[model samples]
Target chain A: MNNPASKRKPYQRELPVDWWLKHAFYTKYMIREGTSIAITIYSCILAWGLLRLSQGPEAWQGWLDALQHPIAILFHIIALGLALYHTVTWFDLAPKAADIWLKGKKLDDKFIVIGHYAGFVLASLAALIIITL
Target chain B: MSHTDSTKLKRSHEPVFWGLFGAGGMLTAFLTPVMILITGILVPLAIISPEALSYERVHGFATSWYGAAILLVLIALPLWHTLHRIFHGLHDIGVKRGRDWQQVICYGAAFAVSVFVFTLLLQML
Candidate 1:
């Protein structure tokens, strides 16, 4: 008699290598993956802030001075761009990731995505106002 | 009879899995803003306040029980969320073999990094 375990079928059948690449959601996933890398790099800036604090006033001042340089500003701008992209994609995917159920009805993904974006914009505006004041 | 029954069971459960994944994504979206607000306020305050900018000062704050708790939550949650997202992404991209092993690695790395960061924060405090 044949071994039943060995005779069992594989969990997944073979498919084309490019199958994922052809799907739209796969493209979104790639974009999000890239954004995650940018976010990781951006974290280094915060690490630097922590390092400067630990080093005393002179070191902290030096870090601030370097931050004022044009090249540094440019790097920051690029990082900001990456961060913004990450934020947008993250919010966009949020609805797809979590289905909001109220009572027996599921809330629409678009509503959730849009609401998050609105909150982001309002909070950013508030922060800007507070900082400028 | 066996093959047909198995296929039917798999089809029935697929929707449930999709629904759960969708719910997780939405919750992350909603929480992202609060995270931004905290970081935005804290970073600028840390920058502008000379005392807060000092290692000694920041360390003082971080060493406090409150600071340690905040640091722990801030670092851990985002990393965990991102790791989950990355796992799903890898699976989506057809990296199906040894997926369990991949998940273990992702979670382990996130935990290790969070611990390292937390340790650094504590040391400074």
Candidate 2:
């Protein structure tokens, strides 16, 4: 057991810490992944809001009032930008993952992308309208 | 190594998490921006009336079954996608220790929050 055959160290090259910083593609990919942090925090904020809501009106209203702060507004703006970036990247990859055949012809990727944008627009409009109603 | 092993392969739970990741990614792509715009931007800026998100109105929405479902999906589903990304992102950034624990903590956080939100919604209803 002390001399296991697979225990030998392999000659693996050390990667530079900032390897992702060296290329535009890698940088964008890192930023895309980084959006998860913002989204996670935003979700936590909402979760906190729900908790406050559960406590009663004063607590809930306090939560709302807190959102009006400058820092919260800035964070939201940043989060919104990141979310849009996520949307663009996600839709770009969508067509590659989905395959549809129609009348002995495969659907074009452009159409799939366009359809996604249309759905996005419509969904946003629907949410906005619903909230205000 | 013994050659007398069972022929069947051990199953991985990847597909379940992958499905959640896909669904969450789709939802985040389509709806998250507008949600932030409304909740964080318009409402706080008073471009939309505060009453639009007033506690009374929101509470009314939360008490309904459909509303509870929407809230659950919106709050919980995205964590699956984000945490999945975060788990992999840690690898990208070179924190290479304890991969198994990293995965556990990432997904565990998502699952914990999901249950937290679910319980809150259930209680409210």
Candidate 3:
């Protein structure tokens, strides 16, 4: 008699390496999520900046000057694109992740999305004021 | 079938990790773009003067209490977010072996870097 385990046929479906490429929504989601890499790079660069800062003026100046290099400029451009994508995607998805209800009714998704953008604008203005001060 | 299903599920303490990831992602979503706008695009393009981020000024800011806090949050939490994404992305791309090790390596790097950043930030303060 065959063992019961042997009698059972397991279903195996291989997940594609580029699974996100299979559909539009998935591709968008993956790209949005993938922007974190650029964010991570910026974090590392900032850490280096902090180290240079700790070493005093000359070191920090050198680090700042490095940012002016063509290569650095190019990297920054890439980072900018990624950052924009991440920001937009975050606002777009906030409603889905945050289940907000009011007066025993589900809140509108648009309000959630708009609220994110509005808050972002306010924060950006605040940061600008602080930086410029 | 029920027994097999039950046996397969080892209760995962994912909420804690996910909480960190959410916080990091939220922070990144708002601040990072503005950062890029100022430092990367505006300054580099000379739309905002390069002197805007001069060594003396930035260093002074970094050594301040609030600045240290901001820098620590900006630098550290997002690393956790990125590593978490990469960890899950690996699984999404069908990394079939040693899931435990993958998680450890990913989150371990985030943890180590966060500690390192925290220490460095305190030194600045």
Give the candidate number with the greatest lDDT: 2
Task: For candidate 3, write residues B43-64 as lDDT tens digits.
Answer: 7677777677887788777878
lDDT score, candidate 3, position B78: 85
The DockQ values of the predictions, listed in order, are 0.17, 0.89, 0.60
Query: Candidate 2 local accuracy as lDDT?
Result: 0.95
Would you give me the overall lDDT of model 1? Answer: 0.59
Q: Considering TM-score, which of the candidate structures 1 and 2 is the better prediction for this target?
A: 2
**What docking grade does candidate 2 earn?**
high
Which candidate, 1 or 2, would have the higher DockQ against the true structure? Answer: 2
If chain B of candidate 3 is superposed on the true chain B, what is its TM-score?
0.82
**Candidate 3, CAPRI quality class derived from DockQ:** medium
Estimate, for each residue in A11-110, the C-alpha lDDT of model 3 and write its tens digit. Answer: 7697778888999999988887688778888888877777878878898878877887888889989998898888898888899998999999999999
Worst lDDT run of 10 residues, candidate 1 chain A, spans A36-45
CA displacement after TM-score superposition, residue A54 of candidate 3 (Å): 0.8
Which residue pairs come into collision in candidate 2?
none
For model 1, the superposed segments whose C-alpha errors exceed 4 Å read A1-25, A58-78, A93-111, A126-133, B1-68, B92-101
Per-prediction TM-score to the true structure, in the order listed:
0.57, 0.95, 0.86
Error of 3 at B45 (Å): 3.2
Q: List the residue pairs that clash in candidate 3.
A: none
Q: B1-125 in candidate 1: lDDT tens per residue?
A: 56665467544644543443354334334443333333333343344343334445556666788877765554454555566667776776678778878878866766676676677777766
Q: Give the alpha carbon lDDT tens digit for every residue of B1-125 in model 2.
A: 44446765678999999999999999999999999999999999999998999988999999899999999999999999999999999999888888899999999999999999999999999
